[model samples]
Structures are given as C-alpha cells and as structure tokens.
Target: MAIKNVVVAGGSGALGTPIVNELVKSGFNVTVLSREGSTTTQPAGTTVKHVDYKSVDSLKAAIAGQDAVVSVLGSFAIPEQIPLAQAAFAPGSTIKRFIPSEFGVNTRKTPGSAIGKILGAKTQLVDFLTEEANKNPNFKWTGISNGHFFDWGLSRGLFGLDREKRTAKIYDSGNERFQASNLPFVAKAVSAVLQKADTPDDKTANQYFEIASFTPTQNEVLAAAEELTGGDKWTVNRVSSAEVQKVAEDKLSKGDYSVFVDLLSVWQYADGAGHAPNLADPALGNNILGLGHQDVKESVAAWLKE
Candidate 1:
C-alpha cells in the first residue's frame, strides 16, 4: 500500500548513498542493510542492520517489517539480489513494493550486443520480480531506467572527453541524442516514485519507468565542454559504434573486464546514431514522477568547474 518503512541494500555506495539521503529527506522511514562484516557507518536518522547476504532467512529477518525494499547493489553484486527478492516477497512478508537495482539504461529495449551481456543479471532480476509480482496480488515492483549518470560520466571521463588530457573520442559523427540524468536527479526520481506508490493514480506498480535530466548529443556535450573551457579545441578521434561494440565484445571474450567504457559508447551509439533504447520508448515517466529537469550545459559547467 503506502510505502513507509523502507529497506535499502548497499546504501553506502555512490548512487545508493544519494538515494538513501533523498528517501530520508522525504521522510520515509529508512533502514540500511550492510554486509555482516562491513565497517561503513549508516547515515543518521536511519536504522542499520548487518546481515549475511547469502542467507534468505537473514535477509528476511532484516526486512521483516518493511513496506518496500530498494536495492542499489552494483553490477558485480547483482546476483546477491536474488535472495533479497526472495526474502521480500516471501509468503507472509510485509513487503509490498520491490525496487530492483536497475539505475542505468533500459535493458528491456537493449539490443543483442555486449552491453546486453553486461546487463544480463539485471534483466534476469527484472523478469524474476515481474513474475513474483504477478503471482502475488499485493506485491508490486518498479524499475527506474534513467539513461546514464551524467555527473559521474563528466567527472570520470565517460562520454569520451578527457579534459585533463584535452582529448576526445566522439562516437560516429557525435550527433546522437541520448538520455542522461545527473546522479541526484536519479535519486529524486526514486523518492518521487515511492511517494506515489499508494496514490489513487499510481503509475509505478509493476512497470519500468524511464527518466532523464537531459538528452544531449555527443557534439552538444563537447560544445558545452568547449564553451566552459574557453573554446579550447579538444584532440578528437572518431570511431564507429559497431566497431566499438566489436572491440568490447572481443575484449570481454578474452576475460578483460575493462570493456565497460567501450560498451557504454556502444549503447549510446548502438544504431550508429544517438538512439539509446530508453530514448526510443514511447512513454518517458519524468512527468509522471514529478522529477526536476536539468539542462546539459548547466550540468557540464557546474561539473567542470568542480
């Protein structure tokens, strides 16, 4: 029904921490579950529980009285969510809503490519949660598929512009428009979804919601960077999206795990244009969620200034 007591797994992580803060600020009773041996401290005004992640019983006990379970596990730790999901929707559980850890691109529309392999676990979890929700009338799930984390990309040299190196690798003509959201916007989206969970006009139940702060092309991002840095021309390199996907696939086949950057480029430029699967969706849930909009130029200027 109305999601009040909420449990967040991996609440100390980069994206997870912000989501926790927003949920707390929104006045949702928050509980963070860390691994049994984790030394990280939980944020103030929330309860913390250390439990064995591998045990469904331990997870069930920690989340016994919660109304919703929001998971923020990273890619590597995604498999651990299976037990958590099982615990949340277990027979006689109080949990009504389950928000899985899918804070990136809409993998439901993901093409058959390297990025799909990287997101296989996420897709599996979505399917599992959907099936579980279908079986239980009271249980529902929501997936927030924000295109890309914009702020993180800017600071971490994603989107192919390395300000430090004054170098750029613009994807195919660099004119593809794809969805991207700042980290805090994503957190706000989550809080908004939870706030409307029990409303009469609830649109979040058993659905995958897509949101983005801004949808900008690679060239536009470069332009913003150039404008911010007084129009310094970046050393540019161009690569085909297909070739980048092939490279990432080849590297992954060889056990190299550093292919995510290439895969990100491939996802953005998958159609040889800026056609991210999420952007192609007919219905974007930004308006439905009451989330704030962010402009790319302002975001770039602020992040670059930092």
Candidate 2:
C-alpha cells in the first residue's frame, strides 16, 4: 500500500518529463517504460526499461515490481493504455496504482459532449480503468485533471495568445472562466498524489484530484499581458466560440485532428459547453494536494519572457 517504486510510461514527453523529474526529486524509485528501441536519454537517478507496448506480457514483465504506474502517453496512443492496464491487473502483478493521462479536460464524465468527442480516446481508457478497478478491489486508478496547460500551451501559441507577437484571439468577450495549470505545479501535484497514496488508507486512489495555478478569463489574461507589455502594443481580435466550434466540427468530420483545440475552445469559453465543471466543487483537494495559487499576471509574464 505504500508506494515507493513507480514506473512511468512516456517518460520523455513534455508532461512525462516533469512528472518523472518531480518523482525523482521526491525520492521515489522511478522506472521509465520506453519502447523497444527508444534512443532517448532518460533523466538522471531513474531506471529505464525498453518494452513493447503492443505486447501486454512485455509491459507486465517490465513493470512487475513497480508499486505504481503513471501513464503520460500522448493522445494518439491513448488506446494503448487498455492493454497496459490489463497487464497491471494480471494475476501476480504487484502494481497497485495506475495514473492515466487525464491532464487536460475532465473527459471521463463527458463522453456525450463535443470536447468529449474530440478526446474520445481518453474516455475509452477511463472506461477500461473503471471496469478493471471494479474487478479488483486492490487495484486503483488516479487522474489529475488541471483543465488546460497554461504555460506550455501559451508558449506554443495554443492558448490564443502569441507570446512574441503580443496579440490575442479573445474568445467570446474574453470573460469565460476556466481552469489552468503550469507544468511544474502539476508535476508537484503528481508528487503530492503519490505521497498521499503512500499510506494505509490511500485517499488518492480511484480519484481525479483537481488542481490549478489559477483560473482566469481570456480578458483577464489580456489585461495581464497588456499591463506587462502595454495595451497599445497588443492587438486583440474577438472570436465567437460557437463559430469556432462549427469550424472545428467540420474539420473533425474530415479527420482533421488539429481542430481538437478549437473544440476545446467551444467547451472552455462558450456559453453552454459546460466550462470548468471541476471548479464547481470546492471540496475537491486543491490545497490538500499542496498546490498553491498563481496569478494570471505571473503566467503572462512567464509566457511573454519565454
């Protein structure tokens, strides 16, 4: 029940790197599960095992002695988690905890919505986790939903704000509040979850621990950016969330996956797309996870400097 040895899949990715680093800093025995021939170098103070994700037996063997498994697999490989989960729950398997990549939206409970459609693979894996956990009482799963990636996404121009250009695509009057988290903060939250699970009761098991640096509207972010870089230097273009949704849906029909970001915009900033449902419940452990608040100004400052 005490989680000391942890194995992380996709340990070289954007999100996985931070989680692995934080786990190392937290003094957990870390193992990274890479593909059969990954040439990527892993972080220091961690072990690496090359295994075929296609082979459940290989994955099970690689993670045989791990106390917990944390998955940071990309969206395209989301279905790959099902076999990994099965391997974890196999007879004689020692893995007690499984953390799937639920970092973005809360898609486990919204399979019927538009953003759900965009992130259907996440729902599929969640369903598999649910069934597996029900079959084995000792096996538990944890999800960390922090809405959107504020720092990473903003740096990559995914948050509608171009850090270099000083321009923003303000969606729908720029007043829709939503959840957001920085990379390091969410990484620390992962460490907190594992520490909480390193106990007899394990309160973090089978739960989606929601945490955020801060939740801010698009306009609020713009104001912060303007204050950092002067209002006159920044250009703003108001966009309709409904219109973006329409375009995203059309692209989805054509198998254009890039429209997924636009679909998320529909849910995050639109009027009736159920934005930030996790924030509705304050009882959820944000502070309990040792996650502290960060202002939008700080986020803007970081992104602008990046």
Candidate 3:
C-alpha cells in the first residue's frame, strides 16, 4: 500500500525535526503528534496535533487516518510506544507502516554489551510491534539502525570526545571500525523508506533497515579531527574498551547510574571490539534507499566548527 499521510510522534526533537522536514519534502502529508503544552514549531505544510500521550483514545485520534506512523520519541519515553502502537493497529485504522525509534544499533539482534541495558525498552517494543504486525496484516513495522550518530554524537560529546578541547578518550587503540550516520543522512534515509513504501519488494518492512555514513576507527576519526584542528592543539588518551566496560559494570552494580559511566559501558561495543556483530556488513540500505554518501571529512569539519 502507498504511504501518503504520515504521523510522527516527537517531531519537535533534534532527530524528529529533520525527519518531519524530509517527509514534507517527499510529498507525504505530515502531521506531528506533540503533547499538549509543547511549544515547538514544525515545518510548513505540517499539521501539529497536541494530544495526551497517556491516553490510548487520544493517541488513536492523533494517529487515525495516518498511512504511516513514525515514532522518534526519546528512549526514556519508549513505554509510550505501546499505547501508540496499539492505537495505530486499532480497528478501522489506515496505518500501514510503523517506524519506531530503533535509530541506532541493531539492538534487537545485536544489543551490544553496555547498550543492552539502555536498549531494554526499545528491544521489548520491537518484539511487541513485531508480534502486533504479525497479528494485523494491514500493519507493518520498519526499524532503522544506523549504528551510532557520528556527527551529532561527536558534537554532543557522545563519542567520549570533548569537541571544544579537541581531547578524546580513545577506545581500544582507536582502530575499531564501526558504522555511523550523519543526522541529515538519517533523515534522508527515512524519507527514502517512506517513498518506497508502495513497492512490493520493500526490504524495510518488519525489518531492521541498517545504513551508515562511514565506518571509521577512533584513530581515523582522531586523524580527521587533528587535520581540522592541528595535532598540537589536540590531546588523546588511549584506554581499553574492556577496561571501560569493567568500570561501568562495577559502577552500575554499586547503583551508580551516572550518565558518564553508562555511556562508557555502551562505548564498549563501539570501541574496536567484536561486541557489535553487524558493524562489518557492507550491503547497507544506502543503495536500495537511493542515498548518496556524505564526505566524511566535510561532515567532520563542519561538525568541528559547530
């Protein structure tokens, strides 16, 4: 079935905004489901519905008539998805596709050592949606796994990098290659998936559609950063991902829920280790999704300036 009308939950977010913009650009009728009292602005030609996220009836009303539903809600808000999905698959609903917030690693199949705890809600939601889709023929689900957010993550210090100081806690010799995607490319990939929603050979449905901007090792990323901002200005400290993981585990075991330690635990999978099993795959969704590559140097350079 052709997906024309799309509803996006959390369309006001950093990632959701771009996806909403791309959907509008792709000629889909866009609607954003925002909680009442939200003040975020949406793109032109987009309709914003302020509704109660807790109520299934409210969510159903917001989702009604949408051909596709995209949930870009934050990780913590994953429980909200259960009701949202139920409302989408409600009787007489027009929703055909559901894209949950599986925007990072293939957490369902390869939940990395540290990120697994973080991915609990998402993993459970995936199973819930998969079973829901199986029960409803008219409903299908697509999950986009782009590994880590490269440009945005770096800018936000998600990569253990202090962007301003040009200092990094390099993981495992800085040579472990893993998949990553730039923010805009992620939006483009989502647009591409919606565009192809009509085709019978759609590889995205009920599957984890994985894509990447470039798979680079920590050392490669450091080289790029150094080239952008001379080596003398940058400092690097090498540490084993396993060690970081051990520390993180110990902290968490002792009931320390510090964000830093949690992030370090998640980095264990990304840090040049074999923890992430699917990072080495070459047959990404880029070709089938008609996505062109963004120059890594250019992206990194731009991000550094930000």
Q: For model 3, how does the per-residue alpha-carbon lDDT over 208-287 read when each residue is reduced to its tens digit?
A: 77788876777777788788886554688767666666777777667665744345334533444543334344556776
What TM-score would candidate 3 get against the native? 0.91
Query: Positional deviation of 1 in candidate 2, in angstroms?
Result: 8.6
Rank candidates by lDDT, best first. 1, 2, 3
Compared with the true structure, all predictions reach lDDT values of: 0.85, 0.82, 0.78
Superposition error at 101 for model 1 (Å): 0.5
Clashing pairs in 3: 174-219, 176-272
Across 1-306, the per-residue lDDT of candidate 2 in tens digits comes to: 278999999889999999999999999999999988789898889999999998899998999988999999998888888888889989999988899988887776568766677788888887788888898988988888888889888888887887667778878877778878888888888888888884865678788767778878888887888888866657888888878888888877887888878888767777544555444355455766656677778878977777
| Candidate 1: clashing pairs of residues | 176-274
For each candidate, what TM-score against the reference? 0.94, 0.94, 0.91
Error of 2 at 78 (Å): 0.8
| Residue 19 in model 3: lDDT | 90
Worst 10 residues of 1 by lDDT: 273-282
Off by over 4 Å in 2: 231-233, 272-274, 277-282
Q: Which is the winner by TM-score between candidate 2 and candidate 3? A: 2
Cα lDDT tens digits, model 1, 156-193, are: 87777787777788878787778798989998988888
